[model samples]
Target: MSQYVEQGYTAFADHYGSSEIIFGQFRRSRQNTQRIVGATKWCVFRPTNPTRVVVEAAVQERLDRMQTDCIDLLQFHWQDYNDKGYLTALRHLQDLQQEGRITTLGLCNFDAIRTDEICCQLGPGSIVSNQVQFSLIDTRPLHGMADVCQRHNVRLLTYGTLCGGFLADQWLGQPEPDAYSGRLTPSQRKYLDMIVKAWGDWTLFQSLLVVLRQIGDRHGGVSIANVATRWVLDYPCVGAVIIGARLGVSEHRGDNSRVFTFQLTQEDNAAIDAVLEQSNGRHLITAIGDCGAEYR
Candidate 1:
């Protein structure tokens, strides 16, 4: 994000697990700090323990860590399926928004039904957005989340659009990854499992990659990742696609910036869809359940 901001590109940083480490990087680049949107998640406020004190402390801690007076977006995550305390947490977040501590309230990995329920409980136009795992391989949001979001005016801030880098040129013709491979990062291992579950085989995925490569060639030779990100960006209610820029380890700012330069044609959609349709005996929409189902 600091690199992107240095190049004058706007970035959003999430305070998920490593709040200090991630937000600390942004703090170092104070010159371009205003270009970044700071987001953080609340994990401990469950049905049994939700309280105003918890929300206030979490928000303050995030503000202190990010070195900001106000959070651009505060996203919440719930673990228990039967938890009803999420409603209380949202109310408190809304209060924080009114108090100028939070600019927007959003959800991470929330299913359609629960999202709708929250909207109703808080009244219309309650949620500003939702962040979820959305990609060609994980179109679960389309099953029902999109419609609910449309009704409630909640846009989807999508992640995993490239399936943890699996949907890139590097993996095009590679052999199926062994589960026990030491080379697989945790993200890669997780998404590879999703591919096997959503589609059926690695060979089929290679075929999809070939189609994406063909599409990329038609679009001035963009990478497979660009095509994948572009496809998700084009999905209904998708406000943005989150791509991981491994900071100093590697950078794709130049390639990623190209996603906005071209649009996918009808033919491009058809070619990609054809390969996906024949996978796993069903469309990704139904192959995976609604948004957040994988966690449930």
Candidate 2:
């Protein structure tokens, strides 16, 4: 946490259960001199009536857990679109925000249509950002989310940008692993399904890795992961790419920092587009649905 602060990373995203640990680390880092923006999610998967009391308690719970008076950002996630309770929840969250309990409000895994609806109903600037799955493999955001976000002034905080590390050099020439192989992490299994089922076959994925490697080589031998991340960051609407880290177990800060040092040239983009044009990327919007439809 101190090292990341030193590197000018002030924003930290976490879930409710683990938010306090991150907040504690941020509080201790650099004697609290640096400004820390802690963002956490409140996932309501089940149906519920979001009364004022209900919403207040939920926000207060986060405040108590993080030991903070006000939340830097609170991102809400809803599972069932049929249920209108999410709007009620967001209204109360907005109320809390106006009361100064929340600094900013955002959404998690929301589709473009609903995001537009929320922003329109809540009035412009009510929603600041939306966290969604976006990468070279999953370009659903480009289908409509990007346009909606641009129209509403909402930034995209993207995850799955590395496809759970499948975009890295270690997997460049590796054979497809069994999903049932207990060795793979949960994220690996999830993204592996997207690759073999929704995105393309393993052979096509290897082609992508090869092109990424070639591009990285052009950029002074940066890793395939660097090129992959740079591609996502290059998008205009992308505010930040949320890369997963194992913390003390392993860190890629050095390699990740390389993404900012170089830019992809026209030839590099053309080479990558050649491989992507042959894959199922365009069809994924239909197969998997937009933005967060897979979860629904």
Candidate 3:
């Protein structure tokens, strides 16, 4: 946390069960607090009603946890799309924002149509960003969500860009593991399943890795992860890509720096798009349904 903020990378932390550590870190340093952006989610696990009272309490708890006057971005997440309470919750959040309790408002895993409805209900420019699963493997956002966000001027904050580290060379040319093999971590297994289901066969994925390596070699041997991150970074409507940092456990500062060192060429884009064109099609998007369909 200290190293990253010191490196001029603005920290974005969420309030959850273990948020105390994050808040503690910032509380220890006013400078750190100033350098970080705090975001929290509502309706994490189906709040009974998501009423204004529930929304206010949740926001207040988050504020008290982070010990900040206002949250940088309050992202809302609701599992049941049919539940109308989500709009009411956002309205309360908007009221809180007016009272200076929130700096900005955002949505997490919201599909295009719903986001459009929310924008219409809130008038305009109500959402600054929509956090979503967006990557080479999960291009579902481009189907309609990207257009909706663009129409509403809502930027995209993406995740799963590295596909839980599967995009790296470490997994290139490797055989698919047995389900009970226990070789992959939970995250790796989850994203690998995405590859098998949403992406195509391992053979086609390896082809992508090969092309990424070729592009990297042209630009001074950047890692496959760097290429993956750079690819998503170049996508339209993306404001930021959330890379997980295992603070005090592991860090990728050096590898992450490569993302800024170079740019992808049109040739590189065409090569990637060619493989993508072959691996999957609108079918993948159909299977995924929409940006946040899995969660619902």
| CA lDDT, every model vs. true structure | 0.81, 0.89, 0.82
Query: Tens-digit lDDT track for model 3 on 1-296?
Result: 66776676665656558774476456557652355676676656564576778778988887777777788888888778777877888898899999999999999988899999999999787899899988888888888887987798998888888888888888777887765588777878888788877778778888889998899999999999999999988867898888876777657877888899999999999998999998774576687688888777
Report how far off residue 262 is in candidate 2 (Å): 0.8
List residue ranges in candidate 1 displaced over 4 A: 20-29, 32-34, 45-47, 281-288
Q: Residue-wise lDDT of candidate 1 within 78-180, one digit each (tens)?
A: 8776777778878988998899988888888888989898888998777888889888887778878889988999999898888888999999889998967
Candidate 2: worst-modelled 10 consecutive residues by lDDT: 24-33
Residues 154-194, candidate 2: write the lDDT tens digits.
99999999998899999988999999889688999999999
For model 2, the superposed segments whose C-alpha errors exceed 4 Å read 28-30
lDDT of 1 at 162: 86
Q: After superposition, how far is residue 110 of candidate 3 from its true place, in Å?
A: 0.5
**All-Cα superposition RMSD per candidate:** 2.1, 1.4, 1.8
Report the error of model 1 at residue 286, Å: 6.0
**Which candidate has the highest TM-score of all?**
2
